[model samples]
Target: MTVTDTEVSGRRYTVHNPATGAEIGTVPDCGPDDARAAVDAAAAALPGWAGRTAYERSAVLHRAHGLMLERAGDLARLMTIEQGKPLRAARNEVGYAADFLSWYAEEAKRVYGTLIPSPRSDQRLLALRQPVGVVAAITPWNYPISMITRKVAPAVAAGCTIVLKPAEQTPLCAIEVFRILHDAGLPAGVATLLTTSDPAPVGDVLLDDHRVRKLTFTGSTEIGRALAARAAATMKRVSLELGGHAPFVVFDDADPKHAAKGAALVKFLNAGQACICPNRIYVQRGILEPFLETLVARVAGMRVGDGLADGVAVGPLIDEAALAKMERQVADARAKGAEVLLGGARATGDDLAAGHFFQPTVLTGITRDMDIYHEETFGPIAPVIPFDTEAEVVELANDTRYGLASYVYTRDLDRAVRVAEQLQFGIVGVNDINPTAAAAPFGGVKDSGLGREGGPAGIEEYLDTKLVGISVAR
Candidate 1:
């Protein structure tokens, strides 16, 4: 796993195993030269890659999907080692990532364009969707495999070449994915991968490169805003899936046990580092107490240990900064009088102290003013707030600047649909906690991000429209 680059700087850094906090491998510290080379590689491959028949592109992606499946276990283990997610969760993420590639493979041939009717009988108007050209894809550390797949699959499906800069902390997973694609017969320059410790410099290089026609990113809102502003200089097409403070609303009509389980599933996934993870839980006043109790019991039963361990339910946070941020958020919430229902203390055992570990926390009596209630606490922390009426709760849920994803738990089908329709989010799950799917469109309505990342809408993000009108002699 030692990656060497003679062209770039001779500096090398080690990638750590989060579970053991041990050095697993070393990667080159890529610089602007590497970034420019990646962009140049993508630019060189664009014409041929884009000119390939849709069927050829689909076949290549199918090969990549097969390779991903063949290496699923290895890739999952790498994800666990670097990202600190439970092995099972990492495996599931790899599977989900493969699904995106397979889905977009089929979608490649289905990028259909419509024909508009013309007033003149002899005139025919045809509109076609074409590739936007070379794409610069920047992925986040959380859900590393799937996030890369979400951006790369669609861009490739739309017949665009890509220069991908994966987060340094979780670069191995993307590297493995790129290796799989390379083994599956992708041209060298069609999909180039680069790893860098410095994101700002690498991002600037990508943004300033005129050959880069589109920029697709998944990260913080601050970074996304800066990238958007820079990309605007060239008027490059941009697709961003940014930060979120998603609310999980449990209505009084919902089954307490079911809602608790669902909430725990969403809140604890990836140590609650996912952008769409439920940061706030708004339970109806009637079922608030029972819901909190059940949720606490569920969280208490979870086993926290190394991700490589078979029965571990939760693992360490990605890094020290993330752990510190979560701790500050918890302290702020407690100072504001929010009740710590169950596990609010960080683990301090000799084995756990070295790595970034936080107890899955549940907070009650949270008001609108509390930082935990309104802000995105990107950790295994859930603040349970009570709401009296549906109108009040929905308003509170939509109050945040982020409109990425939301959850509603209720047996009342009518109420579920009603609440879902009113919630100003891009994706809503009624009973299920998982809102992401290969078949559905996924994106945010507001600051969470612009443009969609799944289904037909995702493909459209990498494509441009062209209209051709022909006049025939009558």
Candidate 2:
């Protein structure tokens, strides 16, 4: 069973498990008409949803969060089948996804209006927050459930209807989320989920439709820009969490072993598929060797196999294209003389042969000329670069156009604060690898895209501020 009995957009398409090269299931191959229908449904439902009191909407989101927790194991298994993260990671993600619903459920009631003192007697000034009408959300394959929940939860919690187009590769997991929402008493048409192999037509309709007042996207920067451009025609509110080439910086004062362990753990989380994962690790020249050695040994001991397998710390890449991309990046680095200190080739075993597996890899002597240093390596490969001074490391880290998440490791309070302030990235983790939470804002500056997600600001992305002024009639 899936989210709805809504008729397919002409046909259905197969969804495969990247871990096994096997078909898990099929979903509706939604297209333009489906997109239009979803938007129309959302627009129609917006008034009723928006008219509801904050408490009323909060009730539904709270119910959904509870249901998510109850069905977590099932959802996690489904995620592993389609999205291919380790089962443990999938379970954790399920909780994280539910956290958004819980967070926004409370945030709903906290959407307070402001009353301002009028300049003249008998005059009144007020600021109000209201739902931004219909929302069109597009989420990526990586972190499918949380991405959807973050967008959908806030929009619904803010009393807005939504039309979600989850990535084709991981639509099944999204279906389960939609089903949970529906069962949680979300009114029909208040939330529409369109699973599709072809997104161009759907995205086109969503962007072109005037009914969609807001567009929230979590995917590639290229696609986000294109969508934002088209959405401009309708003056749609846009929020984008795009591609990241996050740099993990370690200063000389930092514990080399601790920093390396942190690097290995974070760099391999989700098999390095996360947008926040470090693309480049910069270590102070004094501690570079120890960091590299610890990083190499730890990553070398890590296990890689099917996400469902016992003790498998890492899982397969999403598909052959991802594997090929990792191969090319590593090849480019090797050709440029970077040392491959650990596994640098595709993992091959009878159990892993059919999967899109890449061995956890580590490379040192990374230079600006290497592709891994420049491009975001969305795989289990860690590239280490050495730096001498804070100014030099900060410059090297901020060299990329992307300014999403970045990390810095140092025991010195002044250095931690200084480097974090100097680094031109959003959501810097000073001595902490995972700084994201339901209460803190997550976004980027520069080409990393615009607007913010999570925290109190997340719901604001789905809200519009209105001002009211009254003049004396006497």
Candidate that scores best on lDDT: 2
Q: Residue by residue across 1-474, what tens digits does model 2's lDDT show? A: 222356545689999999899988877888787778788788888888899999999999999999999999999999998989999999999999999999999999999899999878989999999999999999999998999998998899888999999998998888889999989999989999988888898788888888889999998888889888999999999999999999999999999999999998999999999999999999989998888889988998889998898998999999999999999999999999988888899999999989999999998877789888878788999988888989998999999999999999999999888888998998799889889987789899877889998999999898888999989786
- Tens digits of per-residue lDDT, candidate 1, 130-197, equal 99999999999988999988888888888999988899998888888888878878886888888878
Superposed Cα deviation of residue 335, candidate 1 (Å): 1.2
Count of clashes, each model: 0, 0
Candidate 2 global Cα RMSD: 1.3
Pairs of colliding residues, candidate 1: none
TM-scores of all predicted structures: 0.97, 0.98
lDDT for predicted candidate 2 compared with the true structure: 0.90
- lDDT for 117 in candidate 2 is 98
